[model samples]
Target chain A: MYSTTYHRPATVDEAVALFAKGSDAKYLAGGHTLLPVMKQRLAAPSDVIDIARIPTLIGIEASSETLTIKAATTYFDILSSADVKRTIPAIAHLTSVLGDPAVRYRGTIGGSVATNDPTADYPAAVLALNATVKTNRREIPADAFFQGLFTTALENDEIITAIAFPIPEKAGYAKMRNPASRFALTAVFVAKLKSGEIRVTATGASQDGVMRVPVIEQALAANWSAAALEGITISEEGLMADIHGTSDYRANLIKVMAQRAVAAAG
Target chain B: MANVQLTVNGKAVSADVEDRTLLVQLLRDHLGLTGTHVGCDTSQCGACIVHIDGRAVKSCTTLVGQVDGANITTIEGISKGDELHPMQAAFRDNHGLQCGYCTPGMIMSAIDIVNRYGADLDEDTVRHELEGNICRCTGYHNIVKSVLDAASRMKLSIAAE
Candidate 1:
């Protein structure tokens, strides 16, 4: 384990100020990923900022049609919270199945989305829901925020403040999780927008992390049915290949999981 | 070092720990409250489960400073004098544990689950909720049974009182 200074700031401004002071500092939301890397000496930062105490990044707020999830709110919190389960409950349902009990209790929405781990479940949901990722500086559309593998649009000294997802008319998220780590092997998020539009996004299937499926979205827009994917072949281009699954398997999984998600949504 | 005080098992304990000190380390090293174990340094194992302000959290991942004034409850805090906590009694009666490495954390999480969602948890719900705590033994048959039984007993006891 590497020795490092730890800082816990009460406010987002205070946390961002420290990040500005030490540009190489890492923000600790769940330590679900960062701490393990730290102990393994894979990531050695001069300072570790524990932002769990940052009041600005905690709590869940729901207006009539929009559900705002504070960045650092734990997954289990979303899963168990009655208000969250009642409004935009797909978020709560998504949390209930993510990772494991320990990881869900520790992992934060902002941290997961910001990390852009290709195998993560949140990005697909964020993208499908057309959510807004609020940062210390500005609000970023989920489509633009996720750039590529282990990369995001978030800049140094920028802390994700909250994420706001508009409540959809009907929505569901489904995933085939990696058994050992429980990360999404390939997950699909399908939502029926109130305006009669349909969106579908796939995670853990592409090498570029999460990408919107225009074909599936188009098919669903025309006919939101499980049978829509019967003849369409999802492109396997630029997908990850690993011992867990091949690129072709993930490509096939995108169609299968998408069908499953659409079926569940219906 | 930060001077922090929190109530554990109904007694307030204060300590001076570095800002980086985890609650598990503070409880085990400083306070000698060994019931809260640290099974895996990775937050994978829920061996360090404890209740902070009535919600269950894995102590291994929580900073000591974070719970400074929160009403904290450990496994040691569960017993009411000579009588065991209902979950503990249920675990013992149902053979919910083997090697007993994960008992405290399991009990903590199980209690929280029952308190938050009631003991009406089905087998699948129990399994899903237990993703945080790992048990190599029992396949969770008796562990889940223990929590369900404890929920019934606690409800009856509360009703009787």
Candidate 2:
């Protein structure tokens, strides 16, 4: 929202070049997240590089082993994509319930993942599915991608090009949505990987950001059923608490949503 | 400053705007089309909703530079001469509005719902899809009824065409 030059680049190289020229620059994808922050004066970059129109970052490619999503692909595209539905229906379902319809039409996957909002939906999926985030500079695995709330492994000028999600043997997601913003109050994503590993992650609950629920992962690994998680309890420590929910409540939600996710995965 | 060219409401219009100018500013301020209201400057309320390239998007959240070459359709452009669009007509007949502050956006989003889900939309689908457009007057009952009515009417018109 501040006075800044806007550059619409045709390619990743051009975008990077534009970024290098500006005193401060941010890659503009969907603008759902960046524009709002800028409008509020929380951020004022000298230049905005519009990478949403770049042809290389605009489609979904689903293969037997992986589901490759271009960075600028919108949430609506993911929800409506037959390929996404066929390969990772849990992700499609998550996309459907993200923001409202209008938000879905413009908000991009890369934007969400890059912003790395702890309450965002994509981080849980990316982490649980063991995805690889491909950026202009390098590829970062989901494990190393998210650092904390509103933080990622991305450098200041690194532009995410695409995300590669390895097809899971089974995966499902469930979340308790904050009614006003539709952000997750507490959400869980459970995945059974092709390598016989089970990854369970909970978002919007931890102050440290999206984290692996080792208890749920171990339980699902053994029995692979909701019943296996019957007696498990998540500790209230390190969980986030606010007016919406207490740490105890979120810890409880972590257990319940993880069970639901596992059941849905089946 | 930026040079923005858009096909707004079917009119090819060009404007010299600030780089930070929102699309809603272009319609309401630059073009004098005030039907697209900005209820909440943030993206929470859908009063600024409009069809950009035939998809419903929040105009306030969208920058003019972001949609330089796009086709935009706001509430004022939906009608033909004095005739109301079926969605607008349905809202009137069903009493879908109270203060009518959210009517334009509601009508725009409703048309998008019908376009995506088709004429066979049920009550739950209409209610769920209406999540973006909030009617502060608490008139969603009539709004839902209006969307269903419009879907049926639009179906008949499509068949007739």
Candidate 3:
């Protein structure tokens, strides 16, 4: 790794100040993803402001209506949390499936979401559940949060503090992992609307990050069945064609996995 | 290099290390607790797994300064010198190691698993939890069995206490 000045700030203000002091300064959450990339020479920040120590950035509060997770909340905390399992087991299950115990123990949901890896599972859940991402500057809706690959609504100096998701009537997430990194080659998140509108968000297969599969949603809205996604053609017009899966294979998986997700949700 | 102080293995340690100093480096070079192996240069391998404030974490990826006030327990801290930890004993009894490169991480992670899930864990759960740590040796069959055995033993031990 290239040399960089490391600052372990106790408060967000101090962290942000440190961040503002340097052009290439980055907030280090769990460092599960950031450190690896830096070590691999994929990214070399001039400074790293450690945010794990800020108490304001640490919390996992669940109420009767919604669950709010602070950015510093580790993936293992989500998986081991009783409130998460009771309210949104799918999110907890998402953490359980990410990497292994060591990574989950060190990786935070906020890091995964902010990194916005197309293959990561949290973004799919965020969009499907209509979660709100609270940055230092603004609360961004999931609809407007993800822009494209390795992109989000977050600005250069903006710091994310928390993410909130409303308790849905029912939801499920499923993915066909790449087997090597265990990242999704194709994943689908299905959420049931009390008004009978089904929202289907597709990840890992999208060329522009994650996109809603309108046809699958429309078919599910018309007929809530595994067969609803059968004839619905999910196009891979600009989807990512990776070594693990061709664009066509991913496009087909969008349909099959959406069907499986709908079935799983049901 | 910056002056730093932290609690490692339940003792206060102070050192003058560079800003680029990683926790693994602090443990190995400064403190001389070299049991935590650095298997993968990246964070993929859990060969550097250790407990920071009682949570399992990859020391290799974490900066030593981040763990200033945290309680850290490594593989060297697990056993009581003469007597092996139940997980270590289980790994030994079950032939859970061959090259033994990943043993420390596997054992550390297994201890964390048993602490969280108890002894009733199924085979699939063990496999799922061990995903972060890679082992080219032993095919993970014996490692999984070792974890299951350790889980049982630790559960009893925790219950007895």
Number of the top lDDT candidate: 2
lDDT of 2 by residue, B54-101 (tens): 999999999899899999999999999999999999999999999999
lDDT for each residue of candidate 1 in A150-262, tens digit (9 for 90 to 100)? 89899976889999988888888878987556788898899997877788988888988888889989988888888988887987789888999998899899889888888
Compute the interface RMSD for each candidate structure.
Answer: 2.5, 0.9, 1.4
| Candidate 3 clash pair list | A100-B132, A207-A239
Candidates ranked by lDDT, best first?
2, 3, 1
Candidate 1, chain B, TM-score (2 decimals): 0.95
What TM-score, computed on C-alpha atoms, does each candidate reach?
0.90, 0.98, 0.94
For model 2 chain B, the run of ten residues with the poorest summed lDDT: B127-136
Q: Which scores higher on lDDT, 2 or 3?
A: 2
lDDT by candidate, in order shown: 0.83, 0.93, 0.84
Model 1, residue A45: displacement in angstroms? 2.8
- Calculate DockQ per candidate and list them: 0.39, 0.81, 0.72
Off by over 4 Å in 1: A80-83, A101-103, A195-197
> What would you estimate as the lDDT of candidate 3?
0.84
Give the range where candidate 3 chain A is weakest over 10 consecutive residues by summed lDDT: A191-200
